[model samples]
Target chain A: MEYAYYPGCTLKQSAFPLDRQSRKVLRALGHGLTEIRDWNCCGATSASKLDDFLEVAMPARNIGIAESAGFEEMLIPCSACYSKTVVAKTRMNRDPRLKQEINSELAHQVRGEIRVSSILEPLFDAARSRELGQRVSRQLSGVVAACYYGCMLTRFPLDVDLRDDAENPGFMEAVLEAAGGTSLDWQEKTFCCGASATVYDRETALDLMGRIFSDALARGANCLVTLCPVCQMNMDAYQEAYCSRLGRSRRLPVLFITELVGLALGLGYKELYLDRHFVDPAPLLREMERQQETEAAS
Target chain B: MQEQTAFQVSGDAARELSAEIAGRSEQPIASCYQCRRCAAGCPVGEATGYLTPDRLIRMVLLGDRKMALNNDLVWRCLSCYTCGTRCPNGIHTSRVTETLKQMAREERLEPLHPKTDSFHRSFVKTSLFWGRMNEVGLMAAYQARVLWSCLKRRDFREMRSEISSQTRFGLSLFRLGRLHPGWTVSRGRRELGRLAAKSGRHSR
Candidate 1:
């Protein structure tokens, strides 16, 4: 079980927890994730909105690198990176002329043979494996989590080929359930957190975050889980800002699915970087630890 | 309710605009019948009073090029694809928005949301320089741009509070080793630069 991992820019800087936990979980599952050597930014929304050529060229260059390295499958952890890379690959494969133009521009030629996939695909497969249930040292039955997919993971149904409904995805929930956790049915699972708009349009982003937090709370979720870095930042870091604006005191810890998976596998808190979250997940981890002890004693 | 004025499209401009969009997007805009299903699902459409996804499509179909290009909604779009995924007519509103945005940039049309424009520009500039995003550099440039705008509007208090809050949050991230003040250039920066320059020339 080996794949070339694309961590993208955010994972190295803002979303280190996602990067760390993802690596930890992969290693724990007996999988090897070799970082895509010398990868650049995926050019995300800004490049795509600004320049069509650069948008395709940026990701195409990285995919070309993966192809040149002889890796058939590349696993991208960040949803934005996954979306951008997958979209570029799909567009290039669809239009050979455009592909040739991009390849000519690139220093390395993109063969279009390598497959781009989200880290969730492999994680979900591992969860479905028979060994996953036996490896879960801690059952997270008491922790009710609302799985938030945000926009990129399942945005384009046909193009992305996600395993669940794009609007109401259940792949993350399925993975969580396999790790002995209860996944809450929440409406805001697929809603946008206003993304980069969080920087420019604070009010709208906060309003959107407020709606998501309230929905998760209303659905009786103890915490929120996300696969995208931006979503985690918006929900975790800005939770207090939105709460104060709405005049509410409630707070819900937001965790990356990687962190949650790492915890269920009996990884230590420090290794999972649980303290790095804006809204502390320590209390929740402690509660789960206490529950596990009581269950063992009973 | 306010009186609604009927929009009239010049025949030649309408045909040219329709042809141009068709040639670029390869999606038939004329197929859209003002169904408003895209509007119903769009998060920005619901949040903002203007520039609903349905209205954007209608404007393009009607050949209101100026209105379509000049509207603030073009830049404010999150590109979440909610409208695209839910469109009854198979029109991806976000893709339409992207095409309009690209046109807006090429035409040098002034954006209604200047901060978003600056952010996008700074983002591209940072990537081209480092072959990866320099988070610290991006924040510095963005904050400087935003602060200048705030000062021009005499919103000093707002600017002060925002900078302080962001700094505090940044410091926390810095403590956690999630942020750094230094640049980490990728090994393939030279190749990335070459690709970017080639793409830039191609677009022109």
Candidate 2:
């Protein structure tokens, strides 16, 4: 499959690994990837608060670009971008008048036909087809992951074209399992990760992050895996502060699902940028390797 | 039935406020039936100083504009949409919060969470400025506004805290190569400027 990919703001810098490996892995799987020409920010949660038209128009602009570029599939790795764009398209499709008005202001016409999807869509498809498993060079035998959905992707199932159970999503689990990782069933799979609040409202962000981490830890999960940059960044970067605040020494690592898939697909730590995360996953991977060695000895 | 009243909506101004929010957010605020399912599922229910999803909806319904707009709930909403997914009435509290925040800003009311407001404003402004966000630009702009607000209030303690925390966290990010020194703008400036101006006019 060919895609016009939008890297958004974070993916270009802070979350570049997700962008880089998404390109490499998707290409390796025989998928064509093209970065959208001059795609702008989707306005995210901030846009909605700025102006209603902006919330729709900003993302609508990207959709229009993709549509005009004649791309059938537009893959956005960030959940915030994916959610806002999908919601904008859904609104435009539902309201013809709004569509026409937005179109008049749009530099490009939004035909509302280009299919937008999060990174999960392709990964899930490959996993389902066993194509991902076939290419898994290293089996993630001892890795246990908690697949996190982080609100935007699943919260508006009806409004957005997100195909999953918002309350109980398992696509990530299936995808990870194909890479030989074990996924645990946890209650906070669909919890909110306090997106931009991570910057402005540390109290709320930390509290939300703590709850998800506690739940995942309680379930005997080794790490929390998610596609949302906000989720990954906060949970991984803030775990130390949370641990210090709570006087708990145990740290929970948060990994981007793509990074784990990269590891399974024989990508190196530096290559996937795993070493940059605050809560290092190298120890966890080493522990997993030890467990596998013990089992082999037995 | 058991008591004098559990909740009630009366007064024209209050009802009008509810209607305005409903219309602006396009959410079915009228259908929110205090089911508390939203409260049951809200990730921030415990932390939001008694402003649960259902209670916020109740406040909106009752037209408590001050509380509705400047409350901890509005400032801290994650826009996670969990409440909307569970609302039998399909009322998205996230949308309601967004609308209330916008209204609060229009009223020129000082936001209870000045930092959040600063972050939001800087994020939007920088995104509009570059058509894509330059992380350095966003933080610099947001830091300036927040510091100015602190200075205006003469809250030196907060100013110190903000500076220390930002520097510590930001340095870590810079080391990890997340905080880039470079600025990258997109090629969609024409559309962004046109849309921003058009939206502002339409909003008015």
- Best candidate (score: lDDT): 2
Candidate 1 residue runs with Cα over 4 Å from true position: B1-8, B149-162, B201-204
What is the TM-score of chain A, computed separately for every candidate?
0.97, 0.96
Show how many residue pairs clash in every candidate, following the order shown. Answer: 0, 0
Candidate 2, residues A1-298, lDDT tens digits: the string is 9899988889887888788888877887888988888889888888887688888888998898888889998998898998888889898998998899889977779999889898898999999999999999888888888898888778762366557777899889999999989999888898887778878888878888788888888899988899998888888888887767767778877888988888888988898888888877888889768876887799
Which pairs in model 1 have colliding backbones?
Answer: none
Docking class of 2: medium
lDDT of model 2 at position A211: 82
User: Judged by DockQ, which candidate is best?
Assistant: 2
Residue B159 of model 2 has an lDDT of 93
Candidate 1, residue B36: Cα displacement in angstroms equals 2.1
